[model samples]
Target: MEVLALLCIVSVAFTGLTRGAGLLPDGPLNAAVGEEVMFTTTLAPTEIPFISVAWTFGDKPIITSNVENLTEPEYEGRITFFTSTGYLQLRNLSFNDSGEYRVTIVPRGEQQKTGTTRLDIYAPVSNVVVASNTTDLAEFNSTVRLSCSSSGSSLSVLWLNGSSEVTESDRVQLTDGNFTLTILNVSRFDQGPFRCHVFNPVSNGTSDPVNLSISLSVSNVVVASNTTDLAEFNSTVRLSCSSSGSSLSVLWLNGSSEVTESDRVQLTDGNFTLTILNVSRFDQGPFRCHVFNPVSNGTSDPVNLSISYGPENINLTKSPSQEYFEEGTDISLICSAVSRPAALFYWFLNGDKLSDTGSELRLMNIQISHSGNYSCQAFNPRTLRDETSQPSVVSVLERISGSSVTPSTNLPIEGKSVNLSCEAAGSGSRMWMKDGSYLILADNIALYDNNRVLSFRPLTKTDSGEYSCNISNPVSSDGASYNMVVNYGPENVQIAGPSEIRVGETLTLTCSAESTPSARYNWTLDGAEIHNSSVFTKDNTGLSDSSNYTCHAMNNITGRTSSAVHELSVTAIPAQTSGCSAGCIAGIVVACVVVCAAAAAAGGGYYIYTRKKRAKSTGDEGQDNTAYSGSQELNYADLMSFQSKDGVTVQLGSQNNSSKDARDRVDNSRPATSSPPTYDVHMQRMRSAAQPDANGAQIYAQIRNS
Candidate 1:
């Protein structure tokens, strides 16, 4: 927008300058040599889509539509004309290109409009040089003529004594449009160090200064140094000046201020050499030597002295705030120093050199071994000096992991010592919990190993619960739980059942015992094994199913067993006494023995037998035989049932001759193997097989318990 606005302003100004002549004003548009100039015309949008356009410089055509070779040969590659807006750009401008430009635009259905602009070119002022007729002039005795010259057209010259313009005066005279300056009746004040400033319409130029002094011309005033390698406060150096002149006095300067002699600074060799015994950093300067004799003086070019300094005031800082960092984290430490030529940094850990050689030391994925006192030493390679910073302690801690509570015995026995220790891979505090609550220590519960281990001395059944151990540090926390169970006895063993029931009713005897692991149950009837489960059931009970049923419970861990006894009896209903007028009713006690013989088949034959031993029946043989008089009594037990693999249960009935007498007790044991062995067996403790007779009837055989 700024560039377009400038073009618009130039167009408006050109239009105003040529409003009367119906011509275009191209320049008095000032442009520098080798630069381009633009001619802009404020032409309204063509109402009729004009096609006829032409441009000319004076009488010769420069460019025209549908015309070949019409552009002047000199302006072939340097001119561009936009027929639509009547704009023109002339490049690589020279003085010979100054002329009048004409553009004619012919719009459709309208007559042609002609715009004319005049161009004038000027050269840039350059190479301005001011000179004196004679440089050797006494300040109070000789006069000087200073002339200025430059290369440019329509140029003006201005003489300057320092920054003030040298105007016409009685002592200073200017001629040829101030191109000539004459300083007459010269004095020390008239010894002018002057300049010539020349400029034209295009550009301006200034000449280097020229000085006129008295006595002799001081030339080649150079400052030489004894040595450039000077250390701060450690080496002595000298700065001397040499120039060709006679009767010249010497002056010295450090930067803009003059250097004077003092205790450390000495002037030797006729004040030409400025020496200092101790070359401090401040003494190294852009020093200059000036030689003058009352009216003229020459100073050499600035010569700077280089001095090496120190690596001092070393400092080191750490991040992230230098607090405890967890393993696998990162930290950075930076070392800094105030020194000349930038100090070289060397990092150290516990007074040992590190491989890192920069200003910063970054420890990534830090571990426990990375934690230590860290310091930084800055070395001045030039001064051969080193300074160390105060050691910064960096602490990296291990993260809490693998935290768990391990019991000395996962399942400890009751009334025994047990220790629950909390362990982790990292350093952290340990805490113990019971179930989900903080454990309250009692006489039996205590802590050891800095509370890492929990001791439960003489553990009881109450100690069986869920316990958790939590280990934690500033970085992380973890916990593990242990479900504890204390082994105890099968105490308070008991059995519940009806003491008497009908012969066809069910006699259910359930036995239980208090123990950590469930106790194994055994049911016995009249000292014979009746069942081996917690609940013993006998359906269709008979008179023979009467006697002591004992339950034995045991804990494998405690190696202890306890038993309880239950006596149950089954009785038969008496037959109705309908013998009224039917005299002499006989009380018949008939005993039909049904013997249970072991049987086995290749495809799982069923056998029902009781393990009642005959020894028990022999002891009560007299009572059993007397109670059922006139009938033979057999007090033999039998296996009454067996279950096949297909879940088919076969029940066998045994008719035993029983007597209601305390002395008539029988003892049964576990079933024994049958006499004949079968090839394919499905029973865990199968018995021998008993073959059938010729009439396809089963033969009876007794199985005595061992």
Candidate 2:
């Protein structure tokens, strides 16, 4: 009856019996249970307000007006009415709610209009499951039936083996709307994990997997061995077999015969492993393993064993084994031995092993140094043994000729370019050595022409050396030597001397310079040549020595000269001193010395005082100023201590330079010490001394005894 109602409703929707046109797509609309559905009307635009809107499901009203409680009791809270658009929606619908639905809209001044559609609700596919009629199945004997079941309405079912849909044929059949599958006379290929899919107009579902457990037989089998190589009496071996399927057992075989257990041979791991101890040469066999069950049997591939033995009776042979070979000849030597595994070989020259590792050694372009006792050694890694052959003697002969070194020029000057080339009569390699050591290349030095030439740009003094060129080949070797000289600078000339020295002390000065081919020295005073040696000395320095001295240096090869100057000042050492100032000295008369001589007769008092004596220079060519010497560094000399009657102690130091005579008192204002001392010798500032000769005049009275 429900189906008949849905059919009638669908016929009314598709036909032109519905009132509104262009409303919604014509339908018996399909919906699943527990889902929502909506209906909208096609009330044409009228520019008039809607006076009434109504919706109905079958004969019962779902929504009619805003003030009426006319909605179906089951749809009370599930219905929504849009009065302006004349649309209706229902939520959480059930299978019983499927029927004809209609919506009516009444404009203020027009006749009522209506839209009608059919809503068909279906239950969603759910809870799908698959089951097999029988669990135990066998190939060629058993049958299988797979059944699919689910809960839903208006559903269709399908059978699948893996991902492909299952179809009926001679051994297969699908019954009951494809909800059941059956296979007769099942083969091993018919073992399957099968699934079923069920679908309705609104939904679809798939069931979990089900499978037939058909009894299987053996198919693939393989054998593995412990070792392919076995020593004759020093090894053991194991072989194992493996196969697929159930209820399986293993068997061992050598060729075609069944293997039995013995003291030396045994089977373990359910006869899958065959072990042989103290393996012998006769034990080498092509072995096989067999796997079998009640319904099937299989054999593994054969495994062959190889027995290992010895390296012995070693011998070596030489090709072109002549006693003597010319230099640059080729030779080959081959070594052999009786070995189970082929032996590796090495060559020896005079008992020292060469780098060759194969059974053969080849020497190309041999040199005289290759002449020696030649031999070979053989080693077997399997047997762990070694054998050496008897030695064969070889000799090579050759000669070296015409080796020489030539320079770019006969004379090399410092700060100039030069190169040296080395060559021999034949083709060979050349190396350059200096002073018994390899020549080191520096920023100014370079090598070219396969190291046959050495060059120096802006050659320096360091480049001078005894150089040797060594040329050599397999034929022979020869070397040539040379002595090179570079002429360089007479520069940075320096003189070592004190700038001032006391008269009567030796005044010495020495000069030096940086030069190659040793420098010559010359000394000059005031631009006049005085000496031609590196050192100059004056045993008795006089005032004339107070002048600039020069030392000159010359490099003969480079022909350059340079000079440095030294200034030497000579000062005289003064005599002793007493407390009498020059003031006291000039005032006392020579008659006082006479009076002192007269006092010897009376012994009234000691002579008054002894004046401090001053050493004077009269006619020095480098004459300094006038009546008194300037504050020179020599003033501290000739100090004399004097004490007056009141115990007053004073140091009187001589301060004078003569104008062919004596002159002034001490110049107190001028500092007399060379260093910055706290105090100085000051004059008493008595009445000024008597002015003395600017022209050979004397100031002090010289007392004479006749």
TM-score of each predicted structure versus truth? 0.31, 0.36
lDDT of 2 by residue, 83-136 (tens): 656667888989888888876666665466577788899999999999888866
Question: Candidate 1: minimum summed lDDT over ten consecutive residues — where?
Answer: 582-591
Q: Compose the digit string of candidate 1's lDDT tens values, residues 1-706.
A: 6577557545654565563234355345676668888877666443334566787877888777633325667777998876556677899988767877777766554466677766778788888999888876765567889989999888998888889888888888889888999987676565567899998877899999998765655678998888877887679988889997656899898888888889999998899888988676667788999898744679998887777767767888988874688988888999998888798899889999999889999999998899899999987777777789999998788878887788898669888899988888988778888989998888899999988989989898898999898888777889998899989978899888799886546789999999989888887766788788999987767778778888989888878889998878787644222221211111100001222122343143333222222222223322322322332222322234444345565443323433321112222342332222122221212222222232212112211110
Task: Report the number of the highest-lDDT candidate.
Answer: 2
Error of 2 at 376 (Å): 22
In model 1, the runs with Cα more than 4 Å from the true position are 1-318, 328-394, 434-436, 440-442, 525-528, 539-547, 567-706
Q: After superposition, how far is residue 570 of candidate 2 from its true place, in Å?
A: 4.1
Task: Give me the overall lDDT of model 2.
Answer: 0.72
Our model 2 lands, by Cα RMSD against the true structure, at 19.2
TM-score for candidate 2: 0.36
Pairs with backbone N, CA or C atoms under 3 Å apart (clashes), candidate 1: 24-116, 528-668, 608-639, 609-638, 609-639, 609-640, 610-638, 610-639, 674-687, 674-688
